[model samples]
Target: MVRNPGRRAALVDAAVEVLARDGARGLTFRAVDGAAGVPNGTASNYFVSRDDLLAQVAGQIHQRVAPDPEEVAAVMAAPPSRALVVELVEWINRRVAGDRTGYLAMLELRLEATRRPELQKELTRTIRAARDDDLRFHRESGLPGDATAVRLMYLAMTGLMLEQLTLPGVVPAEETQGLISALVDRAIGPEGAA
Candidate 1:
């Protein structure tokens, strides 16, 4: 859709920073313009509309969350130990903390999408694509309760993210390890696990 995709990407990156720093309630066109170091008119011109700008920011967050081939491979290859789960949780926590404004903006976008069909459709597609990737990982593992592990993995990841947001100071690494170990036990039991 963009002739120079790089320019669009720059706007999205800027949007994420602005959204996180300012939060959804504080974000404004002029704010993004300043944060992006672009002319005030530039953001409006490129994004075309307010909703368009919000959607682009939200889309970028989804893109970040969704596992591309590289990420999936990295996660899959990461030893499959409880420590690996802690690492992954740490990774997700960093992504969320890296831009709280952007994350909050995404939450706002999700709420808005609920009332707008087009936005809802894109969000659905993005989430379903992520779910499918998870399913694929379980399928490839060829381990008992692979499906359950995959599901619980997502749930625990989400819960951790929420915890991080709720109490950023307290999500210790040990808690992450415990969560992973518990999930693994529920999914595979001690006997089935390696």
Candidate 2:
């Protein structure tokens, strides 16, 4: 096995590319090595096993990605408002655009995880933790129906993203934010949720 950090990084990167381009099934040592321009023996030497490679690839993806940063303030502020919606929609737009396959790839990974208990549990924990974070954010912000609405918010985004997957071109970011803004507007009413 290669003890050099640089070589290990190169192999992991190659594995990510393979997972992104051809998904898990296509992620083989020889192919990843070929894709990385590294020798087959070298790639195998670095990765050791296919499961090891997949775990590395999955961990790499998880470490790099974060929940939508649209609510940097809400994630950090109190009594969140319109800015939350604006930031969130912007985050989603940027997310989908930057990596069209990213969200889709997640869906694919999740479906595959159904047959793999460890993977399924890991994914479930990831999702549940995300939901918990959002719920806590809303509660701290004093958003009405903090619990219920917070839950709904997740559904809304998932539904919207699913729509995006199908239509791809529909729902401009501006319009999407506008819709959320309206909801927030209705929530705060004339009091202003500052």
Model 1 segments more than 4 A misplaced: 1-4, 66-75, 78-105, 169-173, 191-194
* lDDT value, candidate 1, whole model: 0.67
- TM-score of predicted structure 1: 0.75
Tens digits of per-residue lDDT for model 2, 1-194: 66888887777777666666777788789878887897667878877787677656655565445654554654545444556544554575567657655565565566667777877777778778877976786676655545665566567677777777657567665677666556545544423444
Which one wins on lDDT? 1
Candidate 2 residue spans exceeding 4 A from truth:
67-79, 138-145, 165-175, 178-194
What is the Cα-based TM-score of model 2?
Answer: 0.70
Task: State in Å the error of residue 88, model 1.
Answer: 5.3
Least accurate stretch of 10 residues (summed lDDT) in model 1?
A: 80-89
How high is each candidate's TM-score? 0.75, 0.70
